[model samples]
Target: MSLFNIFNVSASGMSAQSVRLNTTASNLANANSVASSAGETYRARQPVFAAEMAKANQGQVGTGVQIKGIVESDKPMLKEYMPDHPMADKEGFIYKPNVNVMEEMANMISASRSYQMNVQVADAAKSMLQQTLRIGKS
Candidate 1:
């Protein structure tokens, strides 16, 4: 792949990771929100990604990443017995999101690292191109 292609790939990766980070943050923010019913409870959202492929001269090459879609987890929501809670339903139950705080934190860290790595890759590519130009100047 060309150095310019590296920039495009890195940019796409960074964008995808940004979306992931945002969704993770949203999930964490709503993790504690209580609901009177399961239907009203927040569901943890996750970003789906696909590898973009290009038909190059040599077979096919990966171009970059693309967002497939955002999906909500199918895991069951948490049900708690809070008889006196304002949000309690007819059965004295309060529904909470199934979001696992620890899991979300891990995801946040991973997304952050992935984004950083993409930036480093772009920077490295830029440096390599600059060095190539300097060789021409000399």
Candidate 2:
């Protein structure tokens, strides 16, 4: 692939990772939110990604990543019995989001690292391009 293509690929990766990080943060923030009904509770969302392929001289090459869609987790919500809680239902049961704090933290870390890696890749490509330009000056 060309040097320009590298920038495009890395940029797409960074964008996707940013979306992932945002979703993870949202999930973490709502983890403790309580609702009287399951329908009113927040469900964890996950971003779906797909590889963008290009038909090149060589068979096929991945150009970048694309976000296909965001889907809500199918995991069951947490049902806690908290009679004193104001949001509790008539049965003294409160529904909490299915978001797992530890899991979301891990995902946040992973997404951050992935974004950093993409930045590094773009920086390396830029450095290489700059060095190539210097060759003409010399």
lDDT of 1 by residue, 4-96 (tens): 989888999999999999999999999999999999999999999987744443554547888999999999999999999999999999999
For residues 67-122, write the lDDT of model 2, one tens digit per residue: 99999999999999999999999999999999999999999999999999999999
Residue 88 shift from truth in candidate 2, angstroms: 1.1
Write down the RMSD of all candidates, one decimal each: 1.6, 1.8
Ten residues in a row with the worst lDDT in model 1?
Answer: 53-62
Models 1 onward score TM values of 0.95, 0.94
Q: Which stretches of candidate 1 lie over 4 Å from their true place?
A: 54-60
Instruction: Give the poorly placed runs of model 2, Cα more than 4 Å off.
Output: 54-62
Task: Look at candidate 2 and give me any clashing residue pairs.
Answer: none
Q: Spell out the clash pairs found in candidate 1.
A: none
Give the winner by TM-score.
1
